[model samples]
Target: MGSRIWKSIAFVAPLSGLALLMGFGEQIDEGACSGTLAFEKSRQLLEERPEVLDIAPGSFRWEGDCRFAMQGYADVATAGAPSRRTFELLVALEPRSHRWQEVSFSMGD
Candidate 1:
């Protein structure tokens, strides 16, 4: 009798927890930054720069209500000599109707 009761309690407890989590799952704000037009704009911006070394898709993520973080690469010119190297690029974006309202770019050493 004791073993049977323990088994029933274990099964029912996990199911009840799962039901609560499903009912009140956290809302991720991925939708606000997503749409067909937004994606097209992003693609265009990525293509315009000839200095870009490479880009990792899906690297852009929301930072807050109107800001985002983007990571990629850009070619950097070395000082005192004629040499070029790839730098880790980090940027922030502010959204404007299907386009970025503001963008700040930087290189990480």
Candidate 2:
């Protein structure tokens, strides 16, 4: 009976460790800068701005904590004319709502 218990423990330990590793690996992958919940929320906010006509898929970089820096090209309406401009945004995840909020935004030619 004692040997059987030991054998079961030995068999289960490796499996438990492997499961933990796989779970953490997925979390790391999902936490990447671009394809995350924060990025999607930021994109939605940018699209809703009145001056923004269109936005291209942007590059993203982690700004530590729950903040991110995003840069991309946008077609913006300026003085009744549509022009492509480079834009930068700083966004942070709102912990309470699990949503993203724009911290700062800028655009220039």
Candidate 3:
């Protein structure tokens, strides 16, 4: 039983890793400085359909250790009350891949 379980784990781990690599690799089409992409992802994570108002110039910058930063404002109706929301966004990306993942998104920060 123990050997069978180990064999299963050995087979599954490589497949799981391969799936992850392919998933990330396939997202290479997402371009750099894609506020729209970030906004769309934020909407999903924030669980609100926020209207991204403006992406401020110079608001986007680089951070240490595979991180990038950006900030903007949007009109979001959270808890059923519409209000202007400020966002401090951080992301990670591969330079050539152009695929990005959100690291953190804070509204009103």
Q: Which candidate has the highest TM-score of all?
A: 2
Ranking by lDDT: 2, 3, 1
Q: What are the per-residue Cα lDDT tens digits for candidate 1 across 1-109? A: 9999999999999999999998888867653655344444554565566654345544665656545555554443345543333232223334444445435555455
TM-score of each: 0.37, 0.62, 0.41
For each of the candidates, the C-alpha root-mean-square deviation to the true structure, in angstroms, is 9.5, 5.5, 12.6
- In model 1, the worst 10-residue window by lDDT is 82-91
Task: Pull out the clashing pairs in model 1.
Answer: none
Model 2 over residues 1-109: C-alpha lDDT tens digits?
9999999999999999999999776554433334386678778888999989899857988898689877999998888679999999889876677667899989878
| Candidate closer to the true structure by TM-score (higher is better), 1 or 3 | 3
Candidate 3 lDDT over 1-107, as tens digits, reads 99999999999999999999998765644344555655455444444323543333236666755566676665665566566767777777657775667787777
Candidate 2 local Cα displacement, residue 109, angstroms: 2.0
Whole-model lDDT per candidate: 0.53, 0.82, 0.63
In candidate 2, stretches whose alpha carbon ends up further than 4 angstroms from where it belongs are: 1-35
State the lDDT at 24 in candidate 3.
79
lDDT of model 1, residue 11: 94
Candidate 1 ranges with C-alpha deviation above 4 Å: 1-31, 35-40, 75-98
